[model samples]
Target: MLRRTVLLTFAGAALGGSLWQGAAHASEGRSPYGPLQPPDDVGLALPEGFTGRLVARSGHRVAGLAWHAAPDGGACFPDGDGWIYVSNSEIPLLGGASAIRFAHDGTVRDAYRILSGTNLNCAGGATPWRTWLSCEEAYRGRVFECDPYGSRPARPRLAMGRFKHEAAACDPDREVVYMTEDEKDGCFYRFRPTDWGDLTEGTLEVLCHGMVWKEVPSPAALVKATRHQVDDARHFNGGEGCHYADGVCYFTTKGDNRVWAYDAKASTLEPIYDADSPLSGVDNITGTASGELFVAEDGGNMEINVITPQRVAAPFLRLHGHSRSEITGPAFSPDGTRLYFSSQRGRRGILTDGHTFEVTGPFTI
Candidate 1:
């Protein structure tokens, strides 16, 4: 991973991007945090000395509203002293995002909707300025910047382009927002905003072979899909989650079961893990401040695996009795001790049985 000093030269070119403090990302073959222990009362398996708790469930009363179903990609944002975890609703029609506010002591002080009336909100990135970019996963989906504090109205960012959008990550060093497409033949893209920290307007560029970038002929794609507009755009197999840290942008693709790394400063893209690896069905991704990355599973095993700094990857946590479910969000608290994620479909969940969770322990840095 590139350090701060090494990335300073290009920082001026990219202008404004996110420096997400609670970033998550890859692994050494053996987890630095050790192996998983036996299951707990809630059927959650974690390393010894770690404990899991139920934060919220779909259709259940949280704060004053029912928790949304099919909780998808999530990112954590720091509040005054506490922080907020924002999760997207992958369901279609009116699907949006919700926030669970935690006091400094880990208390759930509030839970409510942040983005609404959107379709299939799948995954989004957290900006350095403390905002959540909620993305719609539908055809021609748009990115909406939602204030987790619920003090402002959410706004749609159409300039990001229209396509089967999946996850997004902001590379402040490059001064652009990196996004993934969910289609089997989708392309990776970057939104170069007119100004840093502002998503209102930007030019969407498609990534081609050899880490080359070219502007989408028609960014809005009013008549055609943006992914198809670029003849030579690199096609990823069902792009999932994406994250940026230490000048490296990491994204996952479920189709070929691989995790890819793009070095912003180096302008290079390559596969770090493949189908034969322990992590299968790779989806949403985030990294630790210590440089470890956690890749969640959309299916298969119901586990969230960690990737150590040595590039070694291993199971960090497993939720039993949720075989029928898929792990969605995987983010750390502001302090990095607690991890927040969710089983998109619970033990008995077909759709509405989703559950948001929190796991706390002596997390290795």
Candidate 2:
């Protein structure tokens, strides 16, 4: 196994488990998990004090609908009695997003499809207004904003631009979104909405050298026209998972096995952690209620890497005995008590099936 790690010098002192050194957490003093326990029957290995449960499995009847195939990116949302986790399907042509509702006790009450008829619905991020921004990872791809509760129909947010979309992180305070692309030579983009919490229309731009912003007149065109036009200088090397934490947008590049932090306020992008050789294929990333970051691995042994407040990167959980699968969609409940994630390939290496599980334990902030 090849492993690579490089120390980065940020602007502030380390805060142990408080925040990401210089970056202040949007929320403070959140709880943290005590320890992780072995999986009961879920086929996962957790910390000594934590326990995991298989909530939904592909091909299983969840609620009235069959759990969607190839569960990819997902996010948790507040519900009446508990919460709902929306997952995207990465299958081409038939790809869509699905939702599973869990009670306050972590018992899943229902699961159903939210967005359908999309292509390669890969990883996505939750919006500030309780919506899921499902990104299609294909040429001429677009983003679909789907209501988590099924209160409204999922529609394509055309104004947000379209170009091999991967994932998005919304900064509600600034009413802007930071997005990642799946191409090896993709550009990092940001969408500034005309109205806060409204994603129907927006101005799309890409980050260039010197922290400069270049307008993308037609995102769909630039992606398919010259192909390398937008990737001339700022290619992110297979941009993958992304999430907005505190005031910074953190994302990963699978090709480089690096996680980067983009401070929208400073308009600067810098590496925070580089994986040791064995820790490659960084995928979907999310944060705990306490501001700690968790990143899923797309391949390499299928483990989830945790970044503590002190900026230490370490493996937190491993998909025991699973060799052909990768971990995706690492998300947390709104209250920060339970952690949710999915395995792209089934536990038994079944290509057509996947599983989603929840880990609950004593979490500290």
Candidate 3:
């Protein structure tokens, strides 16, 4: 497995002291939100002055729609007087996506299903055209383009390639979509649409070492053909979350427990953070308008790792008392004032259902 390979490959150097010591966080005085506070009564340990409020929990009904289970990936879009936050369900058989309309004051007014009849709908990326691309994380998985306002029915975007999918990020300037795979031997992909902002059809290419581009003959079988069968390309261990900011594509590798940044223009890749140094099990990632990266830890003593532009890593928020679960989502509002995320499996033994929350406070400007 790629996860096994990555562990055998980088386990020895995961704490390669000197190489990453320089990347450690600066003193608290340099922190943008200050030191993190203890877990609040709501089970979230956030930064000072920050508070988290539960928006929806599993089985809750909103706008005549019973909240979906296992809310995984999500994105927020501007709406009338507020915005809509769309979340993907990781349930394999009943995989789908949901949308919750949040008022400007941060309250969820109504929630409804936007996409249905999918499989393992995982993390996805929001597009410049104000649509959400909900990704399926199954073998031969697909990306579905969804409209949050319910103006258009969700459509499957076949050209985006298939694999054990994770999340995607769009380069608004280039109109290219960057995606990640959740397999240990997964490859990072880029989809160039024939028409800008359109994902119905495109060419898919995998990023190889030295930033070289290699076209996947049949992206639908990429996992079987190149990743497992022939298996010669350099692959990331369990690619999870991805976000594009300032022309840079940043994604996380869960098995390797690392975050990497790819500069498409320069075709260069660089590591930003390592596991256990401050965070581990890196999953869904999002970039703040300020360019800082927020990463949700998957299934551990769950905590959100904040990586500054300078590469410093700090504990942004921790999910206290949650067991057998991890944090998902982690998207910011259009204005970047409010942060939204979900506890995939909810608190251990106490709340078995999934739940979503919104965090508001003095976010860095």
Candidate 4:
């Protein structure tokens, strides 16, 4: 059975006001604190014109986030107003099947417990067709497409395959979907749908990065050459966050902190960025309207790293300390005005619960 709860007021703050109005009162201008520090294992820091405050927390073991526009045109609330879907990877006794929903105002609106007996709800992405694709980052894991409204039943799109899927992105125009695997010798994958909007009966191919990585052959040959064998070997570390831009797709590897760009036409993967400073355990990523990329680093520093068009990553938003508040689930508002992200506070050794925050910024870079 699905367990659902709604909290219209959190920390004594009422809903229906601006996002920051209640947060300002609850925090009193003091930012949350953690034990880790920069240059070591610390938290995150914000830019000059930006500030981050906890909007909701302690609900469930939060993973990725998907923010949708409210039908009523109000600020993002947590009731059942605007849809804020989240992946609750695990609950102490609830086992593996669960996801949370919130109103635009930060209220605990409803909850759906689906696909029970699963684990490691790491991160997921939204589709252009308005469905949230939640990936299970465990051996022999699967991808599930959830309906935000809770009106439709949740099911897995098995054509996308069964593996340690970290993140996925869709191209509505071309009817193609890209996915990243979480393994040491992890390989990137592309799925071409038979129908433009349908995800059934498609071809899956792994990226082989050599001289032939750039060449394209029949879908059948491409799959066979990449050893597209669906096996039960569930240990590797090659995937994390991914996004599709223009005609290309970009993804990051948590094991190495390396970024790769895949050309759909060329059928090749090219190195984009590889920094040596901090272990780039990139968790989630999203592109801005201006074409810049924002990556959520889930390692030593709980910060959001910014990658410029020229492929340079600098400290974008620092969360102060490790505190286990690894940043994940980065998404821009439809208008690209505000940014939404989630923090999984207990994963990286922080002893706190998970939560979500919204950052208002006149982003420049």
**Off by more than 4 A, model 1:** 1-28
lDDT of 4 by residue, 285-355 (tens): 77765556677777556666665543334666666544555666677655455666666663444423555
1 or 2: which has the higher lDDT? 1
How does candidate 3 fare on TM-score? 0.89
Q: Point out the higher-scoring one by TM-score: 1 or 3.
A: 1
Off by over 4 Å in 4: 1-44, 60-85, 88-117, 209-237, 346-352
Clashes of 2: 27
What is the lDDT for 189 in model 3? 84
For residues 93-191, write the lDDT of model 1, one tens digit per residue: 979999999999899899989999899999989998889998889988989999999999999999898888898998887789999999989899999
Instruction: Kindly report the root-mean-square deviation of model 2 from the true structure over all alpha carbons.
Output: 4.1
lDDT (C-alpha, whole model) for all candidates: 0.84, 0.78, 0.78, 0.54
Residue by residue across 1-365, what tens digits does model 2's lDDT show? 64445434344422233434454322112123323355456677777678787777788888777887788999999998699999999888999999998888877788777899899999889987889999999888889999889878999998877678899999876788889888877888889988888888778888877788777767567535313555443777888988886667888998888888886666667777675633557888988656677888988878786776654566677787667888888888888888888887776776467888888766554
Ranking by TM-score: 1, 2, 3, 4
Model 1 error, position 148 (Å): 0.5
Per-model TM-score on C-alpha atoms: 0.91, 0.90, 0.89, 0.69
| Candidate 4 TM-score, true structure as reference | 0.69
Angstrom error at residue 64, model 3: 3.1
